[model samples]
Target: MSRPTFKRILLKLSGEVLMGQGQYGIDPETCDRVASEVKAIVDSGVELCMVVGGGNIFRGLAGAAQGFDRASADYMGMLATVMNALAMQNALEKAGVDTRVQSAIPMASVCEPYIRRRAQRHMEKGRVVLFAAGTGLPFFTTDTTAALRAAEMGCDALFKGTSVDGVYDADPKKVPTARRYDELSYDRVLADNLKVMDASAVALCRDSDIPIVVFSIRDEGNLAAVVGGEGTATIVRKPQA
Candidate 1:
């Protein structure tokens, strides 16, 4: 079958991808490398935006489990995503790509507040928009934020860039026999707890009918390849009739 096409896409990046072989924190070299990849896509005429996770800096659920108040912890987690978003914006701008950072939590000094129409205008003018702070609410993962933003922006697809190239039946890093999926039904991902994304995120995407393409961002140039429909990745959406 011919690969699916996309005019606009939302790229969801895990905070861990910024670590660049380190135990923690953002790596400048890594950020620049990822920016280069993004620049390639934008230069190809694909409208792109991003939602970045904060596990590399801090995770709200983990913080809450470690004695912090759940709400406060989640807010802190949201702040971490803002940091990642800013870092990405810096890198992308350095790569000669116009970029904007929108935060759900509304830190006007640092970035613009999340305004859907404003963001849409940014993309329409050929700028990359980065959505930060998951849904502006506690307890929602950035995965869900990605889905929400993708739907709001009318994205053609959602690209999830992680360490693994695709979704697997098991943890491929741990399970030698784990099988990677080329495509999967949303129901199967949720019913079987496949973890391609959080349940709410997967359901939102399914509801919005946006295909989630899971690919490895750690592999340099893989983002462009995946966006071009020539890379190895897994696509999750409703099962065909």
Candidate 2:
């Protein structure tokens, strides 16, 4: 595959990645490592923004499954994302990277509200923006938020950092012989339910013509390598004839 040169990118990280080896919550060491990877990309002059899921702290659907009010649960989940964003902001700042936290839900006291122009300005000033609160609405995953923000920010690509290195035909952890795709069409992924991301997120990226790069965040330094198109990852975009 040819290497892609991207000037700006949005990184979507699962909240579980912040858990490190633990069962729940943010792990300081993991945050620091992730922050360091981010710093490398920034040093390379790639404008970056991030959207983090709240699965490790709270999951709206999981809460609903446990009998909590759906909307209320989703709101709580959004708040969890804010917490994760704050943790990431702290780590990034400690790494000597300028960072800002923007929440869709508008907690003025904790962070700035989601403002596209302001975020763009922050990036122009070389500050990473962490978008939290998952679109500030129920029934939408942080994946969708990433796609939306990536398009709005006019990013070159959306980098999805996951536990797995790339999208596979089957669960790689369970299916020893599962095939990992070097590249895939967004339609194929959605049609086959490949699970590269939520359906909405996939559709949004497809519509916007934004390539989604799926790579493992657990491997230290992988983030920088993948962004540089020198590491293992699956690129999901429109398939050529």
TM-score, structure 2 vs. true: 0.98
* 1-241 per-residue lDDT for model 1 (tens digits): 3358699999999999998899899999999999999999999999999999998999999999999999999999999999999999999999999999999998889999999999999999999999999889998899999999999999999999999999999999999999999989999999999999999999999999999999999988899888998888999987776
Error of 1 at 133 (Å): 1.5
- Compared with the true structure, what per-residue lDDT tens digits does model 2 show for residues 1-241? 8658699999999999999999999999999999999999999999999999999999999999999999999999999999999999999999999999999998899999999999999999999999999899998889999999999999999999999999999999999999999999999999999999999999999999999999999999899899988899999989866
Model 1 scores a C-alpha lDDT of 0.94
Q: Against the hidden true structure, what lDDT does model 2 obtain? A: 0.95
lDDT score at residue 18, model 1, on the 0-100 scale: 92
Location of the lowest summed lDDT over 10 successive residues in candidate 1? 1-10
Top candidate when judged by lDDT against the true structure:
2
